[model samples]
Target: MRYSYQIVVPAATYAPWLRDNEFLTLFKQVKKNSLVNFYQAYELWSLVEQLEKVNGDVLEVGVWRGSSSIVMGSKLKQLCSEKHVYACDTFEGVVKSDASRDNFYKGGEHRDTSQAFVAQLVEAAGLTNVTLLKGVFPEETGHCIESRQFSLCHIDVDTYISARQVMDWVWQRLSAGGVIIFNDFGFPMTQGITALVNEYRRDSDKMVIHNLNGNGILVKVKV
Candidate 1:
């Protein structure tokens, strides 16, 4: 008689359970009351866990009304003591994408937000460590962040040129174990993100791509 031996594996830790629960609760409470959407809230919760692990600064491009930034800032305050959260945006409605390029907002238009409005929301969130950078990304805004480095960078500009500019600007600042999440990766309309990912994959062997909620995440590993 022949006998086979089997090995048992222990259950893996559910890192996102608590965060998801909190997000779900928040979602239920604010789903109909706020302009902030559920998808953005979920993404905020997801990045919060990663930011906690790295204990570094959090940078977000295209902050609208400080919704996601507030979520990230709150988590950063609780998880890391020395880190700061920076939010960049024009504070106006979405800028028009390149006419020659295809992106999620190719034909669509976005409303302009005000810097004062965003600042008010940030203050309301009780986020003392949050810094608001008011301007368009990758242009006048690039000069504001010179030597800053981040552990978690969220790119949600919703256009090819803007997304590419954010990636190029933050790539060097991203820590080796940092994560860069693209908000429109899987959406076919955002060809710019798709192209960016393809180009990024060519040179990066440490990129872990994930498809979640029509978005794409590229988790970078330290060399």
Candidate 2:
């Protein structure tokens, strides 16, 4: 009935980001614009590499400062991939946070950003692969991208209802080998996300992976 908390220290000694000069250089510029930690950012950086052969574009539902979008866009640019990154946000903060399902977030918690701010960040990164969609995702902004399919979706809404809505909406649009990474699944304040991710564990059409860096990775198995 309640969520448990624990610190995860990955046993593996591998540190690929340290050796990745390009990633380091790019992350350094976006670090100040992001709330995502170093480990998680590195994970995002690495995950982009896996989508080389997958069809469809990338989708990010919580573009606070455009850091994650830029990171993925930078990778896609490097790979010379034609895939685009649809970065959606309310530009007004979080929404649909239920007090019963969510512990801390009461909506409008991360309003320290604006569309103009993130746009400038994206422009400064020299990333043209990212398209900023400003509105409530899968609601006001969903129709604009309804025709497109997604290879990877990064959900960081930080509430059970919002996360659930995004998963439900993006499910039909996700390619067979597509991946969905839920950000905010490990923190205590984000217990709602943890609860939401667990609700998806027993499904046959997809597989859920719990990562140490607070990401709930969902892989679609059935096309």
Candidate 3:
């Protein structure tokens, strides 16, 4: 039997962006504001486009500089879809980071960002479909969008607890076939996220996809 979850480092060289000028242009524009690398950003872009017909809004729990959020928003705009991207962040840094379940994060990490900074980045991208929610998320600002259904939820919170909370909060609201992508998965520095994603590998209703680009994608397979 195949392993439920494992790492995949592709030996083949495949770069689709070289032939797709549009994605490359987008990567160049958002490179400065995002910590997400090109492979992850490409996946985000492609996934948003793939789910363009899925009925629901989008959610991003960790809006470090709004780069990945912008990627999704831009893709939505290109498709001329009306889906809105709800971007949440503490703007104060990482919270709910427990050292027992986490590595490399204590608290107050990624605090170099502010709501205003992300706002400007969003504006410069000309994304009118993005909304910024400044807080710790789900507990602090999740109620603002309590009634919203999400087609895509991006969890970059890093810590095991923080990532777990965000995942728990979004799971119910996530529509069937919706996806949750963990940003720091597969990285040694973010063993917490890796652990959290691994714990869900046994779930029946979800399909866990391990991306070589350090992303963990969970797709809801059951309605």
Runs of candidate 2 exceeding 4 Å displacement = none
Question: TM-score: which is higher, 1 or 3?
Answer: 3
* TM-scores of the models, in the order given: 0.78, 0.97, 0.94
> Which structure among the candidates has the greatest TM-score?
2
Pick out the ten consecutive residues of candidate 1 with the lowest summed lDDT.
1-10
Put down candidate 3 lDDT per residue, 123-151, tens digits, no spaces.
98899999999998888899999999999
Q: Output the lDDT of residue 136, model 1.
A: 80
Cα lDDT tens digits, model 1, 1-223, are 1122234344665445456675666456434323435665676666777566674688888786667677777676766567888888887656648756653465334444667877877786677988999878778677877688778887877787788788888877887788887776655556666666656775653585745454567776763
- How far in Å is the alpha carbon of 83 misplaced in model 2? 0.4
lDDT of 3: 0.89
Clashing pairs in 2: none
Worst 10 residues of 3 by lDDT: 1-10
Per-model lDDT:
0.69, 0.89, 0.89
Collision pairs in model 1: 91-113, 92-112, 92-113, 93-111, 93-112, 93-113
